[model samples]
Target: MPGIGPSIAAHLDEIFKTGKSRHFEAVMKGLPKAMFDLMEIPGIGAKRAYRLTKELKIGSVAELEKAVKEGRIAKLEGFGEESQAEILKSIEDTKAKSKEKRHLLPYAEDIAHEIIEWMKREKLVARVDPLGSLRRKASTVGDIDLSAATKNPAKVIEHFTKYPNKKRVLEKGTRTASITLPSGVQVDLMVETPDAYGALLQHFTGSKHHNIALRNYALKKGLSLSDYGIKKKGTEDYLKFKDEESFYRFIGMDYIPPELREDTGEIEAAIDHKLPKLVELEDIKADLQIHSSFDIETSHDLGESSMEEIIQKASNLGYEYIAFTEHNPSRSKHNDQQIIDILKRKREVVDKINYELQNRSAHLRETSARHSEKIDQINYSLINMNKKNIQKARPQATGALATVGRVFNSLEIDIMPDGRLPVPEDGMKTLDFALISIHGSFRLSKDKMTERVLKAFDHPKVKIFAHPTGRKLGHREGVELDWPKIFDFCKKNNKWLEINADPMRLDLPDVLVREAVKLGVKLTLGTDSHHKDSMENMNYGVSVARRGWAGKDNIVNTRSLVEFLELLKG
Candidate 1:
């Protein structure tokens, strides 16, 4: 706690004041206890320990070795002069203390979300955005700031005090409040009215260095700018800005997004404002491939989805399409009939829905024309039609209902096995979508792995690669991706990459994903879900995509149903 006075106290305040205390576990998990102990050494101070921990990731004796092997400890300022001898001596000195650490990002994310949600509800702040190093997507973050635009200041203070079920309010002020939460996440809630919110949000979201640069820039213009507002350096002629965009305009800068708010050259970039549009979640059109309960042997499920359920879930998700890329019969516990039956049953259900929906259209149109207010009501009832009634009515209304809106515009199969892709006798014009996957090649050499994947991409009928790395969470490192070569081939061949959404296998981490994007690779995220429950995993993939800075155009699924089909056809 020695080095933890104001800054550490503030960080602790964040944990205790907000529900996000759990996020710190990962950060602490990555730190060594011995590093804390080292701070207490006779000559060592918290600054030195902070420096050592920052550079070496040293917590105990073992990490000392790791830091040395990683060439981090030797690179520190004073240590660099006699790095060879001093680093070794430092390791020997701390060798007695040791512990293990892990990936701390999850914990940080959890805490960040807590503060975010808290700010939204308590502060009445709309459109709160993350800023600073965390926004930059760094592997680690020291502390976090939440910037929110609110109409009222007193409400902001009240909300922060109430939420995370705060244990105690250590300090309270109009703009800022310090409090402790039950979980030990110390937090500070800073509030600004909507008038000053945008500019302040931009400033607060930046690193100290970035803030300094902006300040210096303002000074050069004979203007003084702070998180509150901007005004002439000598006069109180501070032009009160109404929003973030106006703030940028006042300073002759383009609006800076949260991600690039780091202390780097973002200020200059904002001035030039030539930032490329970042990819967003709405851009995806189709989830080309996913699993079902049928492919349970190699996958997690033993049975496939009831055809009706799968289509309904896809519809609910606003997906124009979804593919059932079940395991091939040759390699799995399924028989040909089982696979056939699943498809057969799915088609039957879809046909039945389409038939009923068609029949209801004429009546729906007549009702809506006479009673325009009843349109949505009529459509809702039509959509709520059950399978039993639809099936029963199919024969009676088959002819009339043929004009109804189709319940399913897109539905397809995903076939996966070891042999060459299934192509039509006519060649290259067979299936709606063909997704290839890697299931058993986790241990192959890099070249062999690369060769197999390259072959799959070259196959004309193969539309997308599923779970490209075959990595499972908390279990295995994926097939080591030879990205430089693989991405090169994908770019040239026009192959799409899958950011598998299975929680255990978010294979294409944002780092590799960004690299793929830089090389002009179109990325796709598939739930690869064995159950309907898993379809929600796409959100996680989106998170990874957001971290990678993907844009809608970069993702294939954000297209419309028609466009998606065309993509498959191409």
Candidate 2:
């Protein structure tokens, strides 16, 4: 709709009705479909696709790979050894991954920020936004989708094609352009006028089913929806909006958060004015899954960051509290008494840190009083008003939250195959509380796995279940468990579930998180950070919580230290 002039539009009605124009067959008569597949490989574009097929009889990816391996491709003019090697590596990479491979959200964010900043400076671009899965905060995303608000579509497309590190421009058109990054990740950009920006965002930020259901609902209301704007059913008139909130309000419902637009009863909730005030990163006051470099000799990876370094970083983040939930000392390496001694030593170190924290408390409060900024990172409705603001909300420090009053001395204990904790009871006594999790034996049956976890929760000090699902994205599926029973146990026994914030393990995923929310099971956020730099991952955890429809009240770590302490005592 954006680049369609009246003259070109007049010829597209029949094409739209039948999916293609009659000239399509004539235009594609001699083209090999395999060339399209080859073009998907990073090192191959349209010209290369044609050259490889024409000269080497390379049609499919397999045939191309064979030709490459046999040194047939390097012999071609305008191709060299370096080019051949690059193409071979790209083919090998394509072979290694599943067809549905998606980049993790953080990785995609890095690329989007760099590219979006580039696009924003273009004179023709009035605004830029991420669309679809990235906008919805999905844990993993496919192609990075972007939209530009502009008065000049053609100029924006030309500028976008010139992105500095792009491997090739896949397609260039009047309304849209696609380019592949060096990593083979595709980025798609669309141009639209500022007045219809909201319509464009809502139309494409879809989780297919959400849009389908929305269209059905609109049809019943004698209205039609499109990227251009809302249309009256029997007339050609359209109503345009510049923001998503206004767009939803015009439809007689509360604005649905992008994270909740997954056809998961969000439409019904919006109509009833029951959409959640979802949790925000600023509401969080603690990071509960930190590991310290203080070595008690762990069974797994030891932390690379020291407790003092982590505290400094946490203070910089405006946190009021944090925990040192390092892995329990290896049971095989240390007997029960040895484990007790190690844990007691850790407790002593934590006590010293807490003592220093108390000494700094008065100064911390004074500093906070001096700086009025609340560090409003991840503010609600992170849409049009400010794109750059959402990424880096504030650099000013709020000292009141600095040097959290005390560092909770905690341990992430591994649950043995038989449901026994690796940490002895005497050792656990030195901790504020413990987080138990399944590190192995993930192949156990659903009923048995649930039983094992419940048994682990039986320990009075085992207050939270860490990374409850035990999933490693892109590698391992989470262990199976009976959720109804698990939720009941946590709700009734005051046990908490953790949403691990690590990019590789965003466990207790959004779907389970929503279920836990319904059953009133409290959840906590943990970055599982071994390095201080990883502490920033807490934002990703908050994203998962928001996606699950969790509000500030549902997340335990959102509480003030006093509130969290009271709950622990309860």
Question: Which candidate leads in TM-score?
Answer: 2
TM-score of each: 0.58, 0.80
Candidate 1 lDDT over residue span 1-570, tens digit each: 566678667767887788565557777786645566555333456666777766666654345556667677566777663564565665454322311122234454677787777676652666666555555544445444455667777777777767756545544677876654454344556777766676676676676776788888878988888877887867875566767678877887887655545445557867897654766555554555555553233333343575456656765665656665654434255555554444455445556766765567667566545664455456557668742433212122232222314333212222223334332223233233456666664677787777767766676756677777777766777886577888888777777888876666776776777777667798887877767767766766776666565778778877775676676666
Tell me the RMSD of model 2 versus the true structure.
Answer: 15.0
Question: Which pairs clash inside model 2?
Answer: none
Per-residue C-alpha lDDT of model 2 across residues 1-570, encoded as one tens digit per residue: 899998668558767788776666676777777687788889789889988888887756667877888988889999988899999999777645532569899998999999999998798899999998999999998888999999999999999999998866667789999887778787889889888889998999998999988888888898898888899877997899898888888887899989999999999999899999999999999999999899779988889999989999998888888999989899889899999999999999999999888878976666555443443423534545565545535444455445567689999999988899888778989999999988999999998899899999989999999998899988899999999999999999999999999999998899999999998999999999999999999999999999999999999999999999999997
Best by lDDT: 2
Q: Rate the local accuracy (lDDT) of all candidates.
A: 0.61, 0.88
